[model samples]
Target: MTLPIVTAVDQAHAAPLRALIDGKAKPLGALGRLEDLAIQLGLIADGPPPTFERALLLVFAGDHGMTADGVSSYPASVTQAMVATFLAEKASANALAKAVRAELRVVDAGVDADLPAHPKLLDEKVRRGSRNAAVEPALTPEEVAEALERGVRIAREAAAEGFELLALGEMGIGNTASAALIMHRLAPAPLVECVGRGAGQDDEGLARKLAVLERAAARSAATDPLAVLAEFGGLEIAMMAGAVIGAASARIPVLVDGFIVSAAALAAIRIDPAVKDYCVFCHRSAERGHQRMLQSLEVEPFLDLGLRLGEGTGALLALPIMRAASRLLSDVASLDDVLNGRL
Candidate 1:
């Protein structure tokens, strides 16, 4: 099916953005990143800063075949176990979602195991797990399309349920490999620069992971991004791309998590660059490659807490900062009000 045409945010609101930021509430440009954030929000909303009433954190869980290569330190079963942890509210994402008052929705994008039915988990599994891209394609084109559709459906449902903002997250072992592939494809940097030690891999493990990805890239050299995604993209990444598109079409702010989510955002941007207008880079992840990815996107994230943990932890941490930015832009008194100089 043809995806809906997602429009970019209105640039015509620049004047109002300046008015809001330069209205003499504080020293000129003293609010720092918060000022820029308020302006960005104004532009995204096409007016003043929007009131984001409800936030939805959608965590897409999947499994990677490359984990069998001993490239990662963690066992492949960790992916499924982590999904279970998310379902049980025992994961970091769950804790952050609770703290931020955001509803967490975990989707089984393509876990290797058959997940038991749970009220909170959306069973949209496309496959048990992807094939090893080191040797062959990870997913078929049909599978990629299915995963993307599942993401779009979920985002639409969340928007309809009154979620004003959406935060993207992922739970998949070996996902950093998928993310590295995406970064290598989208960024100007080469694979070596985009790849990093995920989950604390030793130098040897990192070399093996890089070799596998380099081989994967070489095998898929003549392919486009969709083709590359079919070959190397995880179910979670594809689904996140779909959700980013869906949220942009719905005109909700899309708060992007760290590297993995950024990789999905890169895919979404490839699908439709206009989606960036609705995206907010939540923070700079501690992963070395994430810095290059953010530089490529030309976005300054809200925070930098030396965090490398995915699961939307950084993004959730950023919600309060966004809230504060909106409040300052909309609620704080102007200098004229304080000085009694207004008519």
Candidate 2:
């Protein structure tokens, strides 16, 4: 199936943006990455003074069949439990989102447990959970397609509500195993090299996790993006990829979260190369394979806080920095004007 055509972020204003920044009273590029961020937001807005009046964080929660393979420290039940935490505003991402003043919404993508309805929760469950990727395909093609469409629809809905900035996040037990296998498939990295200590795995658990991922990778060696997703990705990951695509098509900047979100970004990029232009990787995850994924994308993240939490906490943490970029670009005075006694 043809993915949605995303509009490439317009770089027509790059020179003027640099001029605008350089003319500021501060030293040239003194603000460092923040300045680059300002320029990027300007580019995404296609001109000066980008407005980030409303930012929305979507946390997609799912369950992985690989959890049965002794991969994660936690059980699949934790996925639904954390969804409750998100609704209660008791999770790290909740506090972080509040601190950044961005609204957070949780989506039940494919959690195995039954989650009650809530105002803060969106019901878009594609299935009870994905199948065991180590033994079989994670999801059938039809299921994967539905999950992707769910993500695209969510993104478009957020955009329609006047949200200009978006953040992607996920919650799924054993998702790292699925992510590792997906990375192995798409990045074609050594399967062992792709494995990481997900949610605090022990040495033996990590080894077992690695073995499970290897079998999953070998079982699903498809190169096509959707095929890879169906072969090894969770419902949350597939939806996030679609959300990235939908956000790009809507010309909204997406603050990509940690390892799982970045993996989803890679899938989206594979679908449409222009998606990269619309993304700002929030941070480099402490997860082992994240740096490799970022390297493959040829993109540098905004922060490296050694964050391994996967509830969009890293992305929300970067929101203020993004806002500061816009604030400085729109409000900072030029040296020329200051010299003319207009200060």
Candidate 3:
């Protein structure tokens, strides 16, 4: 697969951006994480006061056959159910998307059920659903390639529609299982370290989930990013990785949601390390493995309300924060301006 080239944010711009931020009409570092966020956003925009004409949250939906193995407390049907909820503007993500005035589009990546036509849903299903990873590779290399290509295309389409802020989120039953395994290989961490109580799992459920993942892990020794992804494939995750690469290639900022979405980010970062600079780890998911995912990437997330929702809900909440930080460039005044009474 030919990966997109993401040029790292020019360090040449970092110092000047920081100077501008420091010179803002406020105490040094008074903004705290907001300042850091502004700098990152500035670098992504390749200027101070990073601005995007529009923001779009791509909520990719799919199903995992592994859910049949009791990895999650919810049934696999919930993936399709949640997609409907999202389209009906009844999901938590929908409310938050509206709150931030962001457009939310639900894409069917590989949902098992044949979803009905919906104006809000984008039909980009690569397959009915990924194969059960515990028994065999969830996706062949070809399927992985197709999903990635589609993701890139989707992101490019959003960018073409004047969306500079691209956020990624996912809805897949038992997806946490897929993400944990992906992290196990990509992060090169112990399997236990990568496992988590997804969607509120009881102690017994967590153990059962871990056992199923162990079975899947033993089936592959793959450490390559794409290899691991195919082995423990979640179609939505693969597509999101492609979107991440595409966003970086376009020099746009990608606001990444929690665990499953972060797995895609990790995979994309592995494929192209430079892509990290363009990514905004938007939320700190309550999912335990999410911590390891962030630590492995050596990045800090912007918001942490102990949210474990995975439909880009956290990302929706983060959109306003991102907007405010980006506006620091044009909204706030420099100390010189304040002192000189330029305003």
Candidate 4:
């Protein structure tokens, strides 16, 4: 199915947005990034800055074929285990979401194991797991399509449930490798530039990971991006791309988490550049490739916390800042009111 082409917020919306921010008692543009964020929020909401009442953090969990090459310090089984941890509210994503009062949705996008029935888990597995790209394609074209559709469906459902903002997260053990591959191919950069030491991999392991990605890149050199994603993209990445598109089409603000989510955003932008308008980079991750990805997208995140955790932690951390932006835009008194000296 053809995904909807997300349209940009109209220029007409800018005047009202600027009025909302500038009417505040603070000197014009005195709020700095907060003022800019208010404008972006108003544009995304297509009205006065919106109150983010309900937000959802969707964490797509999956496993990668590249794990077999000993690229990651953790085993492939950690993917399933982390899904359970997320369900148990023990994972960092869950903790951060809880701290921010954002609802969490854990999806089995393509976990290797049979996940036991759970109330919070959304079972939408596209495959048992991706194939090791070092040996062959990660997923078939059909599987990629299904994963993308699953993400769109989830985003629509979240919107229907009254979520004003959608936050993207992921939980696949070897996903960083897949992200590196995607970034290397999509960005105007080489594989070595996009590759990073993920999950504390030692120098030797990082070298092996790079070698596997180099081989995968060479084998898939002739393929287009969609074909390459089908051949090598992780289920979670494909789903996150779909969610970004869906959120953009729905005109809801999307808080991008970290490197993996940024990589997915890059893929979505490749499919449709308009999707970038709805996205807000939450932070600059500690991972080396994150800065390159950010530069390629031409987005400045709200924070640079030196964080590398990828489970929407950055997005959750930015929640307060977003709230502050909206509050300042809507609640601050006008300079005219202050100057009248009515009191």
Candidate 5:
């Protein structure tokens, strides 16, 4: 399937926009990254500070067949249970979204169980779960295409619904293993460096997870974006990548949540380099491989709070920072205005 065309964010207004920010009633660069964020928000909107009256956080949940390999401390059932928690507004993502005044939507990209219908749930399952990557491809090419297409569709729908910012999150048991494998494939990092204590794995469990992922990475050595995703990517990761592309296509800024989301963002960039221009790395995750992924992208995140939880919480926490950035652009008086008034 042909992906949506996403052009680079326009920097034509950079000079005037920067001047507006610099003229704000504060020391030059006193606000630091917030000022930079305002400039980027302006460029993405292609004008004045973009309206973030409504922010949408998409939590894509799926399961990985590799969970059977003992990669996670919890069972695969936790993935669906967490969806229930999200629906009940008990998950961290739900609370943070409420605190930030953003709408939280859950998508069943490829969970292995049948979930109850809910108003907040988007039932867009591509499959029950992905195939095991240690012995075979995680997904067929067709499944990967469907996940990407669904993600693009979901993101476009959110943009149409007036959500100015889209944040990406995911839930899946053993998905960290899948993410590590993808990072290993995409980055030249060692397999051990890509591995981590996913879901609080013990040292022995971590070693086992590492060995599994290392073997999987060696078996599926193709570096092509689609091929790697099919071989090592989870369903939710694939969809999030597609969503990043979709958000860029619609000219909406995307706030990527954490490590898993960052890995998906990398895949999206590999698919289309222009997608990078529209993404805001929301935070630096405490997950082991996340900083490596961020460095490979060569982008600085807005916050780093040692966040390892995945549910879009990190992105939600950064919402106030985003708003503060825009507030400076919209509310703060310019230095010239202040001086003229005094005269």
Candidate 6:
């Protein structure tokens, strides 16, 4: 597949952004990571004046047949239910997006059940549900390719609609299991470490999840990002990876939520390393392997609310801070003006 071209973040703007940040009427680096965020937002604007004028959160939903193997404590039906809730504007992503004034868009990348037509939902289902990875490859190469194309189209459409930022979220019942496997191969971390208590797994449950993932892993030795995505069984994940590449190609910054979204970002970065430059790690998820995932990306997330939920909650929470960071560029008074009694 021909992936979209995503350029690395422009470094030419970094020095200017740093100077602007330091010139603010505050101690050097007093804002700490906020300064880093401002610089990143500025660089994403291609050295032009940065603006977080509008932001949109894209929550991609799917179902996993791997749940048949008991990898998750929850039933796959919950995926369909949550998609309905999101459409009703009552899901966590909906509330958080509203709280931060970011638009929310839910996409049905792939869910096992038939869903009612909703004006708000994007019908981009690649399949009802992925094939059980334990038995065989989850998605065919063509399915993966189509999912990616849809992702790119969705993100670019958002850009055209005038959203300045893109935030990612997911709602697949056993997606964390899929994410673990994706991270395991791409991070090259031991499978044991990548496995986590997705949606609250107990000791026995965690062990079972581990064993199930192990068997799935044994079925393939592919390390390529696209190959790994096809091997794993989550259409939402594959679509999110495409969205990441799409957002980067559009020269827009992306606020990545915890583990699952991060896994998608990982695959995206591997597909085109330049995509890394446009991603903004939102927070550290309480999910066990999230730290290693962030470590592998060499990024420090902004919040650590001990959140394990995966509806782009962390990303929405971080949006306000990013907006504030962008304001520092045009809202705050520079030291030159302050020292000259120019207020």
* lDDT values, one for every candidate: 0.86, 0.88, 0.90, 0.86, 0.89, 0.91
Count of clashes, each model: 0, 0, 1, 1, 0, 0
Error of 2 at 175 (Å): 0.6
Alpha carbon deviation, residue 65, candidate 1 (Å): 1.2
Model 2: per-residue Cα lDDT at residue 89: 92
Question: What is the alpha-carbon RMSD of candidate 4 to the true structure?
Answer: 1.4
Residues 217-335 of candidate 5 have per-residue lDDT tens digits of 87867889899999986999999999999999999989988889998999999999999888989898888988888888899998899989999999899888887777788888988
lDDT of 1 at 152: 81
Can you give the TM-score per candidate against the true fold?
0.96, 0.97, 0.97, 0.96, 0.97, 0.98
Judging by lDDT against the true structure, name the best candidate: 6
Candidate 4 has what TM-score? Answer: 0.96
Clashing pairs in 4: 65-132
lDDT, ranked from best to worst? 6, 3, 5, 2, 4, 1
The lDDT, on a scale of 0 to 1, for candidate 6 is 0.91
Error of 2 at 269 (Å): 0.5
- What lDDT tens digits, residue by residue, belong to model 1 across residues 238-259? 9999999899888788899999
**Per-residue alpha-carbon lDDT of model 2 for 90-168, expressed as tens digits?**
9999988888899999999999988898999999999999999889999999998898888888998899989988998
Off by over 4 Å in 1: 341-343
Q: Weakest 10 consecutive residues, lDDT, candidate 6?
A: 44-53
RMSD of each: 1.6, 1.2, 1.2, 1.4, 1.3, 1.1
Question: Which wins on lDDT, candidate 4 or candidate 6?
Answer: 6
Per-residue lDDT value at 141 in model 4: 85
Encode model 4's per-residue lDDT on 20-53: one tens digit a residue: 6777677788889888888888888776667786
